[model samples]
Target: MAVLPGAEPFRHEGGEVGVLLCHGFTGSPQSLRPWADRLAAQGLTVSLPLLPGHGTRWEDMNLTGWPDWYAEVDRELRALGERCSRVFVAGLSMGGALALRLAARHGDAVAGVVVVNPANKVHGAAAHALPVIRHLVPSTKGIASDIALPDATELGYDRVPLHAAYSLRVFLRMVDGELPQVTQPLLLLRSPQDHVVPPADAARVLARVSSTDVTEILLEQSYHVATLDHDADRIFTESLAFIGRLAPHAGKEGTATVG
Candidate 1:
């Protein structure tokens, strides 16, 4: 299947500090392109990978599952770990869950974690029925591009693949169980108005992560896709500050160190 224009994975080899970025479930890297470019401009190496089963039609997502998506991001994280002295993981929505999983799994290898509207669980009566519903339904309404800015859109499928969504739910629960293993510095950004993920999701992560250095930001003007909404610049700027604080010599030109 042909990848949609602007949905391609992005990589920039810039400096000794690397940031691995993951896109949300069913979402292409297009949703994080500007965020990646912003970090790249600061001379940090960046990897924004298109998760498996994404960047194509909605039906294609049904052929894949959360493990496939996690593997793709994990590969990028390992590649970044090889080249950079410090590596951080960040993501939006399901990508956030993946980022936390990386932090949990890798321990000190991940220097920090950042997430925007990270999802950890599904709710409502519908969620309770997903395990059975997925066996019968192929898809339902998509929960994409939940941005407050008018005319803004995300390059994701128009429908949610039920089986894939069920996989995501299972994956999130797995991450939730491992949250206490995450010890890296954490930055979580949440939008109070987010329609796709509840505020409790962010709260739960904060409560579970073993990291003492955790900061939470409220995106007053955005929604679930806060990276592309009005608070986009704030997310980029604050994330840069977070990275610089942790890796002060990150973008400096003279070093070729890897840790």
Candidate 2:
């Protein structure tokens, strides 16, 4: 993968376990930065890569597709595998889809997965009907509208590329078929009040995934952006514990080996 001119390299703390943290669609690494910092403090190397066309202008997202996003994630996951004894993945929203896809394709390499408000389906018929609007309307770059993100105090580009959304739907279909292939321990953090992805979808994920070692934690107060909401701390704590358990050094390390 050719390094983008301004993108941050995959971040790694000095440790044996590797983690890749992916942010939501059209969002920056800024969303996951706090969680990444906390994980690094616990001595696990973490990578937070900007997906294709994200962290820049929203118009850029129109040019890129879901495959591009997955390709970038795959590159970072491979890089983490090269450096650490064990690798894990965590993602929010669109990133969650990427994480699951990674686990499906590289199950042997990923030790565990933490998914926060994964977007497996678009909630309603309005979204389904407006599928063609993205093609009709020109993407308004960096348009911040409050309606697009009601729970989130921060707003993102108001306009979405319809074709991009359509592409994302196709990616979801692919991952749905690939779900049973992933067998790693899963920590699903979902929000009941999530305006983006419904609770039913989370249930569907838990049901479909073949992993026997799956735990679902419901977030009552937060919406889709759980990373920055009331349950954010819970996400941090549980995710750390989850990663800590699968860590290569967890029970194997002697007291003197602690870092």
Candidate 3:
């Protein structure tokens, strides 16, 4: 399938500390391009990969599943590990669940994790019917571009593929089961008024994760896609600060300052 023009994957080579960013389901790398660029500017090697079923038409996503998406990010993570001394994973929504899965599977190899509006479980009674709905219908409304900023927009599919969404629920369930195994330091940024991912999703992760160092920051002015909303600066600055505190030696060589 031909990829979208602005949805291409982004890669930047910098120091030994690498940051792998994962965009949400149905969203392309465009969603996290700015964030990846900011991290790269700080002399940190950064990669924002477009998942297997994403960055193309919505119909393409229907042909893919969770494992396919996970495989792409896992490949990037392994590649980053080979060149970078330390590596961290940051994701949005479904990407966050993938990050947790990596932490659970890799342990200390993942230096830390950052998630914004992470979704671990689906809500509403309709979620219970995903299995049937996926077979009956091909798609429904999309959950993209849920930003509080009026003019702000996110590059994602206009329709939600039921088969792919069902796969996401299965993936989330798997990640939830492995949450207790995630012991790496975690930074979670949440928006209280997020319409796409409910606050309960974040609570479920916080309660299950075994991480000793967990920081939860509330983004008052943003929505589900907080990375592109009003509090985007906070997410970027706080993420840099989190990386600095955890990988102090990694940032010493770079001129980037968190302010």
lDDT of 1 by residue, 62-177 (tens): 99998899999999999999999999999999999999999999998999999999999976678878999989989999888899989999999999998898898899999999
- Minimal lDDT window, size 10, model 3: 250-259
- Put the candidates in TM-score order, highest first: 1, 3, 2
Q: What are the Cα lDDT values of the candidates?
A: 0.92, 0.75, 0.92
Rank all candidate structures by their lDDT, best first, as comma-separated numbers.
1, 3, 2
Please write out the lDDT profile of model 2 over residues 59-92, one tens digit for every residue.
Answer: 6777888999999999999988998788889998
TM per candidate: 0.97, 0.86, 0.96
Off by over 4 Å in 1: 254-259
Candidate closer to the true structure by TM-score (higher is better), 2 or 3: 3
Which residue pairs collide in model 2, if any? 134-162
Comparison by lDDT, 2 against 3, better one: 3
| 43-129 per-residue lDDT for model 3 (tens digits) | 888889999889889999999999999998999999999998999999999999999999999987899999999999876677889
